[model samples]
Target: MGTFQIEGGHQLKGSIQPQGAKNEALQILCAVLLTPEKVVIDNIPDIVDVNKLINILSNLGVKIQKLGKGKYSFKSDALQLEYLESEQFKKEGGGLRGSIMIVGPLLARFGKGYIPRPGGDKIGRRRLDTHFEGMIKLGAKFRYNKEERFYGVEAPEGLKGTFMLLDEASVTGTANIVMAAVMAEGETTIYNAACEPYLQQLCKMLNKMGAKISGIGSNMLKIEGVKALNGCEHSVLPDMIEIGSWIGLAAMTKSEITIKNVSWEDLGLIPATFRKLGITVEKRGDDIFIPAHTEGYEIETFIDGSFMTISDAPWPGFTPDLLSIVLVVATQAKGEVLIHQKMFESRLFFVDKLIDMGAKIILCDPHRATVIGHNFKSTLKATTMTSPDIRAGISLLIAALSAKGTSTIHNIEQIDRGYENIDERLRAIGAKIIRTA
Candidate 1:
């Protein structure tokens, strides 16, 4: 396991460009399986999870070529369908949750698709019901091997479109179902679908590829089945979660950092969410400039005199992925804030690591945490810790950078799964962070 050795209490300067959205890249990469023509994707983040998906696609006989940094062209004209049942496929495809998406496209184009239960962050119970149920609604037969813990879907007569309402608005589930619906026999209407920017991007890309999709950026999505889809070039948006992390990092360490080329309109409540924590998120054209908080930031209170609560919800609301960053930044704020992470159960457990470093935090439950800021009057003492997940790992890194003395973080592979060249990127902005194997 590699570790990060960070020298704390150093202010970072200069600007950093956020990498392409990891969430979007995962969906777009899977969409490549829907077409036989050449699909050229730009702004692909060179991270572990995305790379794993690409390698899986390559192993399945998709011809891939590197165009440039963060650019790749993929053609799925030929595919090894037998690979789906191989031991190699079982091991590689089960490594990440994104692999589950390939099943939708494969089942759409081919007669069958099989996959081992996918693995990802052990944050909580992430069931595959939504993905499978949506497929079943589209006239696909679903089967599960309880002994092997494997799942498969088959559309022997090909998929037929139907109207269905999802049990929940799941991003990956929505993306998977959308990919399947684009090749169904008739019109498919999905109600309560996730309208995240990344999902919207996937729909637009499919539209460009000859799929008729409407009701974008809304809860209802309408898809008309196409005989076949062609390839197209698409660029991913900057990762909003990473951008939010940088904003929280700047405020926590009292740094002046500018994030370039952030799609401001697509950010939806992220910038405003950070501002609620007393951090200044200034918009200079398309970029976000966060000034140094020399005097520390103060959390806003409710008008009724209740404590400020930051909670995650569906789109247009604050994203749950950045709640960890908000919780970490609130440690040094002028007031207290309650962080409610509704999406995942075990994500808030990592706050205990911050509490060990001299921060005042109350773990109210598995879903909520109360953070009392030291207001910079007290600096966190450096300590050794382990990363639990991608978001929590970055949050801990931000805490380590703002703490006193030096800190060591084990299992940095989790951080690497999301952020591309994070240590080098931080170094460019004057942060004293080193990666040691």
Candidate 2:
């Protein structure tokens, strides 16, 4: 396990570039399996989860060549289908949840897909029903091995395209189904699909590779099966979740930082949601400039004088990923707000760690928390804590950076799974943080 020792109460000032989106990269990387040609991708984030997926692909006999920093070429012409049934493959694939996405493309191309139970952050119960059910709708045979905790799908005669209304707009599930449908025969219509920018980018990339897909940014998507897909180059967007985390860190520590190369049009409802907590965000071209909050900010209330509520929903709504950062920033604001994490059951449990750091927070339930801002009247006292998940780890890091004295955080690997070189990047901008093994 690694730990971060952060010395707090420092004002940071500078500019930093946000890393490429992790979520989008996962979907994009898995799509390489859809074609046998070389697919070159740029702006790939150097994070643990992404690297793990790449390693898994290499183990499956996919040829990968590193062209440059954040650039790679993937060709699956030599893919080994037999590796999917190996014990070594199960061990590698079971470590990350993103590995499950490979099932769709594999089933589409090779007529078979198999995966062991995947693992990820302990935030909620993420089920694979949406993915399996979607594939079954397309005429794939599905089976589960209860003793082995494995899932397998096969379509001996090829998949047939059909209309599917998903039980929910699961992002990974939608991406999986779309990848499988592109090679199937006939037309496929998907209603209530996830419309996040990640999914939109996936559709655009698929279209560039000769797949016919419509509805780039809407909940409904239409796809026409293609005989084959050609390889194409794609660049991922900036990580909006990381950008939001930087915004919250700047606000709590009174820092001024500029996040560069952020696709402003793609970051729906994120900046506006932070603005509700009285943080000032300026857009200069493709960059978001966050000024230091010398004068403490206040949370905005409704017109009827009720407490403001910050909750999460699907795309075009506030993202569930940024709610943890919002909850942390609200602690130092001038008013009270209720945070409702509707998507995940246990995401709000990290509030207890924030409360231990001398913030006023009420854990209403597993999915809700009410935060009363301290308004910089009383400084937070640094202490020891363990990070629970990717978002929560960064939230605690921000809290530690804004608190008085030194704080120690254990289990920093959770943070590294998403953010790329977070400690080094923050240090360049005047944050006093050190990683220790």
Tell me the RMSD of model 2 versus the true structure: 0.6
Instruction: State the lDDT of candidate 1 residue by residue for 1-437, as single tens digits.
Output: 99999999999999999999999999999999998999999999999999999999999999999999999999999999889999999999999889999988998899688999999998998988999999999999999999888999999999999999999999999999999999999999999999999999999999999999999999999999999999999999999999999999999999999999999999999998898899999999999999999989999999998889999999978899999999999999989999999989999999889999999999999999999999999999999999999999999999999999999999999999999999999999999999999
lDDT of 2 at 266: 91
TM-score of 1: 0.99
**Cα-based TM-score, every candidate:** 0.99, 0.99
Q: Give the per-residue lDDT of model 2 (tens digit) for 1-437.
A: 99999999999999999999999999999999999999999999999999999999999989999999999999999888888989998899989999999999999998889999999889999999999999999999999999888899999999999999999999999999999999999999999999999999999999999999998799899999999999999999999999999899999999999999889999999999999999998899999999999998999999999999999999989999999999999999999999999999989898889989999999999989999999999988899999999999999999999999999999999999999999999999999999999
List the pairs of residues colliding in candidate 1. none
| Cα deviation of 312, candidate 2, in Å | 0.4
